[model samples]
Target: MASGSASLMWFRKGLRIHDNPALQYAAEGTKFLYPVFVIDPHYMEPEKNAFSLGSARAGLNRINFLLESLADLDSSLKKLGSRLLVLKGEPSEVLIRCLKEWEVEKLCFEYDTEPYYQALDFKVKNYASTAGIEVFSPVSHTLFNPTDIIQKNGGRPPLSYQSFVKLAGQPSSPLSHTLSSLPLVGDVGSCVISEVPTIKELGYVDIGQDESSPFRGGESEALKRLNEIINDKEWVATFEKPKGNPSAFLKPATTVLSPYLKFGCLSCRFFYQCLQDVYKNVKRHTSPPVSLLGQLLWRDFFYTVAFGTPNFDQMRGNRICKQIPWNDDDELLTAWRDARTGYPWIDAIMVQLRKWGWMHHLARHSVACFLTRGDLFVHWEKGRDVFERLLIDSDWAINNGNWLWLSCSSFFYQYNRIYSPISFGKKYDPNGDYIRHFLPILKDMPREYIYEPWTAPLSIQTKAKCIIGRDYPKPVVLHDSASKECRRKMAEAYALNKDLNGMVSEEDIRNLRRKLKEDPEQEAKNKRIR
Candidate 1:
């Protein structure tokens, strides 16, 4: 708080200059402010533990987007008379070293909810406290602090989206911090600020550009895209989440600002204010649970739940997740991961995900359902892992929450209402244009058989210049039978565990699995046995 002192503005999720509380805090009452980004090995390296199955926390696609964001942030800082100091190694050690070497007076950063990040932040804060350094940490990730919401709701989070909405009440007006100019950097004798590392330097091979994606990462791009949406008053006023067609390509039907949001390139509160401005100008707008603002609230809802709940990322020990015996078929999971499931609709969506590192929300729903309950009946954790590795916009809270919702593990339980991999895409895209765009192998197939390429007659397949089971793979699992079996298994599990509730432990799952495996009656009904 002393004037003419040095402060370090450590960047995490909040990669932007506008509406950044930590950055604003660090700049005020300081003669020198150092903007720093640490490329922590914790995330840059692949997690090789048993549960991870040797997947990197961030794949090339995400790393590429991150590097772009950092470069843009650095450019923005330089314009303001400072540059981002890029460092590598563990965050706590890096920050501690900077504190001593730079002779810093304050340490500031945006707060996050993931357990690993929370722990890392704690260590840094502890060190700062011991060293008698002023520390200022603020929440700018979500519209409202998850802790505040949980405290207001009797120390627990709302289970359902509607309940969450009612409990959340309404988002407050966004806070403003005006600045004519940022602090000028004084001579830091020997502190060499490294430039943002390239994708290869971050220990990943560059996958190159995705032509399917019309997205670019950074605060400038975020604002530009946001302005385009807000300027279209009619679109903003009439925006509907469910009605947006997922099959549309080249131009996303919805605002593709998710990557910006994930990296904190755009502030959620600022976005909310823009939405409000649009609503006031039009004087007519849709309500929550489906509206554009509703989408953001959903993000906060998941954060609140994830913050309060234990074992939120996994099924076994999660209190709310249903105890379904998900299959452990690596081969089936591999096919799903590589976009080779052989169902054209699902495969196309997967291909889009791999290439673009993003998919429309409805497209996400279709694939998640197919992977968990609709087709393969594989564990949702496997799907969650794949998303973590691939999605440029993947956040721990949102990713796990959506997987649980779609898998019928928690938040939802319409087990029998399966998304027909074939029909779902056809409804949005009657001509199978989405399928054809991604899966060119079946691009020439007739519209009727595009979603079900395996069903095309031999002559029809030959004429299309592609052959199923040769050029493209056959359907890994028949939709109808697999869905029915999944439903039956779910019904049985629900019936057996009707009275059970709250944080079913690993031991509990092990016992249940043992019983299910040993029982002859259960074996007779095993979906995989068929």
Candidate 2:
């Protein structure tokens, strides 16, 4: 807080200048300001295999989005007489060295709840403390700090959405930090810093001029999109999640600003304020668990749970996750991933996900259900990994949380309510236009047989030039039979869990499954008793 002290503002997820509390703190009373972003190689490394899991490999689309956001941040900083200094290497090491070499008196950054960042921050804080450098971190990425929400809920994260909403009162209003200028970075001894790296330099194939996401990434673009959505007062007032059309691709039913939010390119508080402004003008608006505001709350809800829950991403040690015996069939998973599932509806969603790096929430539900408790009986973690790599809006907390919900692994227990891959898409796009757009092989297929192309007669297949089991694929698993089997397995798991008072372990689940295989009659009798 001393005047004329040097400050280094560390930029992580909080990429925007507007309503950034940490940035404002770093700028205040500083004689020299160095706005810095670290590019740790952990996230930039190339994957050994395309489908490799448990790695930090980011898809090119997301990487490109990140680069664009950093560039935009730098541009915004430059307009205020400062620039973002992009540093490469391990974050703690680079930051500590910079602190000493530049003689920085203070270090400030946005508070992050993710365990990875938490550990990294600990190291940096320790080094800064030893060197007598001041440290300040303010929560800005999420609406409310997870720790505060947990405290309000009596030392535990509220599991249910309704419970979470009650604990999370109105979010604090966004702060205004208008600035005429910022002090320029001056006189570093030997520390190296550069502008944001090009995609090619970061080891990605240079994105071609034509190969671009329709959703451009930057704070400028985020604000423009936010304004466009907010200006439609009527739409904002009545927007509901269930009413959104999954097949409306030409113009999506929902705001597509999730990527901006995920990357902190747009401040969550700023967006919340904009939504509140719209709601004040309307007489009565849609409420939570469905409304547009509800969607944002769902995001915060996941963050709170993830922060409080141990091993939140994985099933083995995740306390909330049910130990369902998910199959380890790579072939089934590959079929689902490669868009060769033979179910046109499910495959088309996957195609959209791969190509566009975005999908409607309902579309996500359909595929996630198919891969897990609905049909293939694959693990939700597998699907979670795929989404984490592909989705432009993939957040560690939300991605895992949604996969768990859709799979009936946790949060949601209604495993019997399966999303029919065929009927789900038909309800929204009866003509199967969404399928046709993504899967051109199904374009000429008749409308009646579009959702289930294998049912088409050989003559019809020939006429359409898209033969099932030949050009396209036959249905990987019969939906009715597979879903019935999956439900039975889920019931057995749930019953066993109930008998154990929800204290079932991974080994216990495996034992039950093994017992069921060995003596079906005995297991059935035991299940009936339980």
lDDT of 2 by residue, 1-530 (tens): 24446899999898898888888888888789989998877776555566632126677778778889999999999999989899889999999888887788889999998888989999999998888888999988888889999998898899999999898998877887576788877676677878888777766665564444567888999999999999999999999999999999999999999999998999999999899899999998998889888888999999999999999999887888888878788988999998999899999999888777899999999999999999888899999989999888999999999998998988999999999999999999999999999899899999999999989999999999998888999888878877877888899988887898778877897797775467555324322121
Model 2 is weakest, by summed lDDT over 10 consecutive residues, at 521-530
Q: What is the lDDT for 415 in model 2?
A: 92
Estimate TM-scores for all models. 0.93, 0.95
lDDT agreement of model 1 with the native: 0.82
Best by TM-score: 2
Off by over 4 Å in 2: 1-4, 52-56, 207-212, 516-530
| Candidate 2 clash pair list | none
CA RMSD of each candidate after superposition? 3.1, 4.1
Off by over 4 Å in 1: 1-4, 45-55, 186-192, 203-206, 210-213, 502-530
